[model samples]
Target chain A: MSDRLSISVRDLFIDYEIFEDRRAAIRKRLVQHEGTGRRLVRALKGVSFDVFEGEAVGIIGSNGSGKSTLMAAIAGLLPLTSGDVLVSDEPKLLGVGATLMPAANGYTNIRIGLLALGVSSNEVDMMMPQIAEFTGLGEALDRPFKTYSSGMRARLHFAIATSVHPKILLIDEALAVGDQAFKKQSRGRIDSLLGEAGTLLFVSHSLEQVSSMCSRVLWVEQGRLRADGPSDRVIAKYEAFVG
Target chain B: MVTSPEPSSGLTSVSEALSTREYLTAMWKRREFTIEVPLEQLRSTHQTTLLGNVWHLGNPLLFVAVYYLIFGVIFEVNRGVDHFLLWLTMGIFAFQLTSKTVMGGANSITSNTGMIRAIKFPRALLPISVVISQLLSFGIEMGVLGAMAILAGVGVSRRWLLLPFVLIVHTALNLGGAFIAARLNDTFKDVQQIIPFIFRLLMYLSGVMFPLERLLSSLGEKSWLVPLAELNPLARIIDLYRWVFLGASLTGGHIAVTTAIPFLVLWFGFRFFKAAEWRYGRA
Candidate 1:
């Protein structure tokens, strides 16, 4: 990795105040004299890391261990309870269930998504064919997005997010639903992204995928950094703990 | 040549808010989103229906007819108004734009949680798109109102030229309400649930079905409330439209309040929405 700091996270803390159901919340306020029915969840606590340019750092953690939270924080999508995140440029985030206009067809969604990314209408028209080819859903592109399977939705979301060739890409389990063939295609896309000296922060439970694509890995456990080192070394420890 | 630059030399804080100038520039760059998405939404609004886009015109006509039957025939609330049907149509069409815009704005952020979490654009576009889409719908309804006015013998006068100006003022009012509602609903989803009731109450208070003068006269000794009702921005907006289409009388005071309040609300609403920019989609 180069010495150029692509992303710098310093002492970041994120707390989620999840509200209870309305009926339960009302009962708690009335019977137990609770002021509010919010339960605080410390998703990230004093977590800090610096990612260098051209580095593909993979984050591994158990479910609800804040791997996704850290990805989101790095993407600037989450509000930090404390601390700061500094970046060289805006990062593009791609996660499962990230959709636009569910009622619109896949083609329409792709066009809208590109436009939302600030691509002019002319550019979107020119790029439509290539994006459509990449999706590999020729006939299905006419169907509404809400009708797409999770794998299909993931493919469309990934294609649109990576369309503009983002300098910094933060991916959270978006590839988990793709089939073997799609995974291989996306791997080639990721390699081309890296070849351009792009920085990537990938969060996934697949140690194989992480080790294959990333040179370095971070292991987050229960809202704290458990390990940060080379991919093989960190993966070994993570596997020993969770395997 | 061998000197190394500091690692954090050119990095910018990711979570900091952009300056107003920068924010507006970014929004302008993405202006197509505010237009295209809403146009797509409007196109698909009746896609599933048998009658398809025809419902756009048909629905508003039916709405005016139903209101005329109830208030004009049954309730006799059309007493003081000449051309009761046209007046009622004007009021309903104008007021519906604001109500639909505000209600749509209330859910704009909440419903688009997926888009908000996925992409980084000016979040204001969501509510702005709602207003645009509602405005397009209002345009279709206005066409229906125009045809009805002609059939009802309301001639096109020079006052008709002011329709566009009045509509712009009304849009400013709708946009301001939209921004405020979007932020409020994002923070507390209960605001969406309560908005419809509030607008229903407003419809009555704004004299959407009857003449405001009659309501004031009916109020009799409640002289204090007369000025308050007269100052209701929605009433003034409807009055402005009525003046444009029906050649109804309008006061300078009404014109001044209608023009000023919308812009003021828009300024405040923009600030209010931007204040919570980072907090949206956190839930």
Candidate 2:
């Protein structure tokens, strides 16, 4: 209900009810004993956070600590099972970074990726040059995406995903996949975007990245918010916890 | 374990919340969606090759010959069954949608884990794109089957108009299977292994290469499979194809189930896919 905030969550939760086997599920009504008393796995539990316009936040957590889930929920990919996730702008969570239809080439993937992202054709065409440049994948851009190296795929994905310029940019471990050179360039590019007042939520294991890029830090664990404050305070706690 | 109380104001109820139709209408005007034209680019990128676009035709034709040679000529089932290619082709073509929908569609979510994790477009579009792309492949195969049907003295009839309608049902069935597969594939990689085998069993049961008459005569039509054989969901689709193109009846029993069951299956498939629509994006 807070329209001023870019993203506001009040006790957001995501719990999945894993059903029985398909055959058992089909025969469930007819059969008396189909097995019961199993508890659901809660992936995200009563978690809450807020991101306003011009806020660049970094989320850190141990593996399986729900960093990705929190990002996905904010991006609207995952619906909250309980509570609320209110967003004032569109959110883009970088997935597969850059996806290529193995059968298709890089240029092809760019269009489809944009479309898959639900971009307008005119907008995709407009951003094509900028996307191609950011990838730095020159001559290889004409080749099939499958033929490109992982670095190239990541580069291509990062470029196309960032092409339209997202409002709520939620990047999950993007820098972790790229090479040092690409990572260096990625940081600069991201910082420039942040300067332009874009709200970002970056989830990464890299402490240096958390401290350098984000204004605030959010430490997540077991699908709950563990700590939220200044970058130094949270990263120190997270690093300590990991150690 | 802490339980979430039910949402206030009965938001879970279908009528209380924004209906899908209403939301879609609102979206068209406001949302500036980017359509991923992966297909056009994917096809164009590979256009320079020798087989060029012919490879699309060549692959399915090769499959048709392989199936016909193995199941038809070598096995002598061609002589045994009437309209051998027609029947065999029907099964392959009909099941192509199912196989692709089940096999390809199931992995749609798991395969696009990166996309699922990143963006907030319709998750349904991922499976839909798969089915549509596969449908393009099926179109090529169907053309081959249609040509063969023409050569066998079966010309196009008015019934062919229903092809689009049947195709819609076929799409619905694939979409439903895709929804289930997209979610199920997340935990079980084994689903991928068993899909081809399921298609093979269904092919034989649905009277694809072998005729339903043979199954009926040998197994006795009234046996447990009577419903399956008589109603034969797949066989009906093929019959509809043959009846429209080849201008032949695939038996009255075949037509009965084809006309009735597809609609039922389609309805449920629609409901099933929609119910799990949001879950797909998350998975």
Candidate 3:
């Protein structure tokens, strides 16, 4: 599978079957599976793309333009109503609070977060200091993540997620949180990750970050690809589209 | 990386490193999370409220006492099962797990819109934590129930040793229910609104107030209701507590029936949560 394609998606479509309620759902079964009055909302329509071994891609779109939808479809979080996604790696999604249990301590959250990202116990132990040090929380590292401000929390999240070194990292608006200082620190670490042959699908609003971080950019509009090419041109088109 | 020189690493053996795949390999991994944040919040979430840690044991004890007063003294139910106080207390203690999970789990995901909108991890853990956190409370209530059973006049059976298994099943049932309800409530906010009504219906159907069989023989053969009635995982669990100290019998199809709901709830809940995991943070 690694011979050529790193991630392959073909004509993906995601549709939600909205039934009125459970009672209606049960009653619909009484009559027939059909005519349940279920309606389908197409979140992603015929989205097709590929990311090679070391490509960094940016997915840009207005709210509900299917940017997150496309990323999720590829991450296997949402099953496409009609399409296929094949990847050489198990993509780890690093969205804010995506899988992190907030009630746990930064220490325990790291363990759970690492596990969700597909990391093991021993490795997490080894990576612990590096993540803690990079997060720059110092004694705060020992505190509950909830105690830390949003920026502090994001720093820890960035450190732990990058520590595992995923082959393909799916980031959704995680960068938008945190303060300017946190951003600079996080960006430095993330830059180091991208330098090492990891393919990333970053979904964000900052045009500056998109142009700076991505090798290529894809703009989605109302569940369809509206623009695809170099980050500069795509961002420009996306800017106009958003306007 | 915003600056984007590209990352490159060599030399270190990543194989020896922790892989997320290995972590999620088991559906039920009992290890504590490896983080420094949630623990403080969880502790504070519990402690910041009045009564501190005492509430864990106090709340459930209070609930059991009320039921004991109502069932054992006020109305005076419980035909023949012996040690009516112990029986009523234990049964109420056990049944609350379902009611709590139903009410709590129904909105486990929906209620945490803040978390749902921001984070992503094993969604199952949300419901799992709700149930597990109550373990201490259950332990305290169990002690009170056991002592009461002995005082009320019933012989202890060696077979009463099987109580843990029932507790596990009860936990599983709660986990499963929460899992399914978590996902359903996400799509339908109204699910939370109707929880009290459905629970009331299930309350009578599952026999929380009295021995279900005594109410009517017509209920005996209703195979569909049998699972909820006899093996009522909750009732079976409480009865086991009673049987241990009071010599109650933990028999019948209730266990077998109740068992099925957990596994079904688990399977579907997992799939449903996974299906929506990606969409959660999006607008």
Candidate 4:
């Protein structure tokens, strides 16, 4: 909520190496060269931005525009090719494909997911009831996660991810699958994260949701920050550009 | 109107390698995660099996039995070694432990690719946890080894107490091997396919089924292959276990080689593993 910087991404660049074939990828390891078959796809190019504490910033971009890559970079999940990403705290990323064991039941996943996210075992037990209620899978929680419908899976993931009240939350389109009731509940959770003065970086294609929920917006174009300003201004510019 | 943002003083840039202190501290904090996952997996491993946890005991027993038939009954490969059954049992168990630990560790990171990308925990925990799980299974196999030792007319002696000491050294060696395999497999993936073949060759060279000293003496003491065989840490571990359990006397030189090799491997493997910490998930 204060003016302190939550995240500072300075001249950040991420290069994804594309191997034309499996042999090329394996051979590159032995030879230590790009070889003719190896190509570097720069996912984020000289991108720089600063997010203040308690600010909810929506990163809007078309597919392959580096929205998820930027979020992953900020979460310290991706390897940066050049430049720096400085964060006040380790950001919790709630991607739709967040790490849940498909083979395990929902209850087991809740324990493991929370544990993976660094929640203490004792706290995991205490948080179980609330997480169970929020996800509302009920008896279905006993079945394997792979058996759950995609919507059910997303809901469970969202509930477990929000259970810890992260200091900085990075959500990459995890909310897109939920129904109206689930959305209402998640909206409340987001508001609570905001109430606790937590910083939020959301990557979503839903312009209406982004415009309403975020105070500021960032428009990424082909790995570059094309626009950054108040939500209305940036969204207007983005719409005009697209149209 | 928007103004250009200031470069904040709080910015802390990330480098390729985390400091040793920071990395260790982070690992220590998530120590429970490392410990719990393996325990959970072991519990669920045979939950649906009719024999349940008995398979942990049964599987190794069955494996050792087949090797016992081939090497003990048919080939009489245990001819020179006293208490052949006990000797063969120890060798197979130790060999199995090493192979399992290496193979399991090799797959640890690559197998959990999704989790690594989804969560940002210490990457080292993957291999560390693999070693721990294998150690747990090894503990159970040791009990079966003890039963087999007694059945073969070997009694408990002061030398048996030395089993724990050997175990500690052997564990260090396994941990080191696991670390190396984990890193190698993350990159080459061919490392996994090649591991079984490599271990198969090692099994013969390391004297897992037969007495190396008997073969070495037959080939002449001064033979270069003798020292080469002595250099293998797994052979030394197997010989060390046989010495403690079956009362075989390994030469002073052989004992020295066994003791020295594990520590050396541990020192080298750990540094080699740590140096590649940042590359595990990314690669």
Winner by lDDT: 1
Error of 3 at B224 (Å): 12
Task: State candidate 2's TM-score.
Answer: 0.76
lDDT of 1 at A79: 80
User: lDDT of each model, Cα atoms only?
Assistant: 0.87, 0.69, 0.65, 0.83
What's the ranking of the predictions by lDDT, best on top?
1, 4, 2, 3
Question: Candidate 4, residues A15-110: lDDT per residue as tens digits?
Answer: 987666877775776777755566789999999888888899999988999999998888888778898888777788888765556667888889
Every model's DockQ, to 2 decimals? 0.55, 0.26, 0.13, 0.49
The digit string of per-residue lDDT tens for model 2 on B8-44 reads 4222321122366754543342233222332553375
Cα error of candidate 1 at position A92, Å:
0.7
Docking class of 4: acceptable
Q: Rank the candidates by DockQ, best first.
A: 1, 4, 2, 3
Please list the residue runs of candidate 2 whose C-alpha ends up more than 4 Å from where it truly belongs after superposition: A1-3, A12-46, A61-65, A79-81, A95-103, A144-154, A176-197, A204-212, A221-227, A231-243, B1-19, B22-55, B66-91, B149-189, B254-257, B278-283
Of the candidates numbered 2 and 3, which has the greater DockQ value? 2
CAPRI verdict (incorrect, acceptable, medium, high) for model 3: incorrect
Best by DockQ: 1
Candidate 1 vs candidate 4: which has greater lDDT? 1
Q: What TM-score do all the candidates reach, one by one? A: 0.95, 0.76, 0.74, 0.93
Q: What is the TM-score of chain A alone in each candidate?
A: 0.94, 0.88, 0.87, 0.93
Count of clashing pairs, candidate 1? 0
- The digit string of per-residue lDDT tens for model 1 on B182-213 reads 99998788898899999998888788898777
Instruction: Give the candidate number with the greatest TM-score.
Output: 1
